[model samples]
Target: MSRAQIAPPAPSGPARSVPPPPSRPLPPPPVVGPSTRLVDLAAPEQPLSPHDPRSVGEYTLTGRLGSGGMGTVYLGHRAGTHGVVAIKVLAPHLLDDVDARTRFLREGQTLQKVTGDYTARVHGVGFDGSMPYIVMERLDGPSLHAFVAASGAVTDGEMLTRTAIALARALAALHADGITHRDLKPGNVLLTSAGPKVVDFGIARVVGQTHHTPAGNMVGTPGYMAPEQVTGNGALPATDVWAWACCVVFAARGDHLFDGDNILDIARRILDGPGAEAFGAVHRLSPRLVPVLRRATAQDASDRPRDGAALLRLLDRSGATSAVGHAGWDRLVGGGVR
Candidate 1:
């Protein structure tokens, strides 16, 4: 509930391990109060309107970054310092919902231990009056979702390969700390100058940790969620793998693997429909990677890569490493491998 934007339902199954696609930065969504828009990561910050809160505790709010069901995210600067941070303010109604607030705080705790180039570092946590808020490194980049919207699916073979590996590394770090990024999607991944950094840990959970979400209710985007998450069985490190595979395909094809007008349809297709049928078309694009993706998206979690680190190994062994290196990586973050 404290997660980033809710996405269309993803299908459940074992997906073969594959690389995720390259995406550009994301722009903020329309929400109540002062708003700002971004054309891309390099675009200047949109000035805050009169209705926007000037500050949230020690952070001086500068512009609206984005919003979702849980809260509004704003770009801010630390008072008297040049440090920039993205501020997420909890929704007013959820303030009274103990479970929501608890999860919000837990997200901070989960991310606090994760340190690396692949995640948005948690800077501070506090409240703006009755609203709980989180401060994070303000990345000068856009969400993969926005990038795809503007540039179409990433076509550079090397960029896609690098993105997949980077995200896999990020997930490996998260799982090492017992954190499951329950919601791993293009929109939740930000493409920055350094590389792709996973954002919005609002729905992340520790391995085997209990949750406040009701039983039988799904907790993640249907299109990107693992089978267990969709069926309410549970979330594991492999769950993120499944989502990562889906994202990879999306980035390559600029389309959803499972198509439907509603969640039920998507769920049914994932559970009962010919699973391979969905990926049939794209399978032709990169035949060699099909088997890897199949293993990652397998309906049975055991069939997939054990974790991000393992997935990276598979990619390396399978020759996905051919186009990856310092030069390729630079081209990846800089807009394509030459």
Candidate 2:
């Protein structure tokens, strides 16, 4: 069957709600013992070749930022403007895949719909032979994933509150532009000196794009994907919101809510398990934040907060607004928070 013709598997229970399993005594908090140190999470595992050629067009490569399943991201600078930026050069093997190229270009176009400080700004695109590349603003900060790993967990109520606000505002802009960021995770959020900036719009979908996945497949970080995304149905603004909640949960607890050996197993647990137990380990989290998290992580998209606005409202009601204001948000963005 063609890729577009594949159908997502049907969900087993009610779309809106899944009854929780019987309550058991809450588990004790996991021991917070020191482990091996990872001081420089932003440092690339391998240094960039100093002699690597610059982009064919206007930019010069300075250093490597990071590499992932798709490609290597580099720190680059535009010649005339001397503007620093990040560019993702698609993997050589992926250049042979028509679908992958199309998806990459789609991401560049869709990101234009989202405009805000919290979302990375896409500047332009270039090609080095058949390998397509995208140019984005250079955000000098560690990913939230790295921050959480180094700092243990974000137990400060004010920090979580501000982070939620920034993320919600960013998602609101994307939803307004009729785009859905299919992949939203800690690794994709950069904690800059100014504040949190969301990056990596690689797997997003515009409003009218056909949404389908190969059978028995899914395309998102396993622990953070919404139920619909996990089921391979498709993602919407609600899916982003669900992932946003998972991000907050990760920041608050320093552990993934859904634990499994692999993506498929994690998907099954999120679809079928009673997740209330997952929140129990987060003792440092304020009680007021629980309901907001619960709403954000609702099994059904319709049952979750309708949009970023609604999520922001819930956060406001939780009395986090005042704290965010006094927390030196500017200094945090300036790289002082770390």
Best by lDDT: 1
lDDT of 1 by residue, 1-338 (tens): 22333456431111111212213343554331212222233323455555567888888787775555666677888757976788878766799988789888887777787866688788878887887888887776566665666566766665666777778888888888888888888777777777788877777887656776666667788777677876877678898998888877887777776557877677776665236455554355454466668778888999899888888788777776664556755444444321
**TM-score for every candidate vs. truth?**
0.83, 0.81
For model 2, the stretches where C-alpha displacement exceeds 4 angstroms are: 1-41, 44-47, 211-216, 281-283, 323-325, 331-338
For all candidates, the clash counts are 27, 7
| Models, CA RMSD each | 7.8, 10.4
lDDT of each: 0.69, 0.67
Runs with alpha carbons beyond 4 Å of true place in candidate 1: 1-44, 208-210, 273-288, 335-338
Pairs clashing within candidate 2: 193-332, 193-333, 193-334, 193-335, 194-333, 194-334, 195-333
lDDT of 2 by residue, 65-169 (tens): 665546667787876775678777776778898877877777777666676677777888768777788888766556777677666677666667678778888
lDDT of 2: 0.67
lDDT of 1: 0.69
Candidate 2's TM-score: 0.81
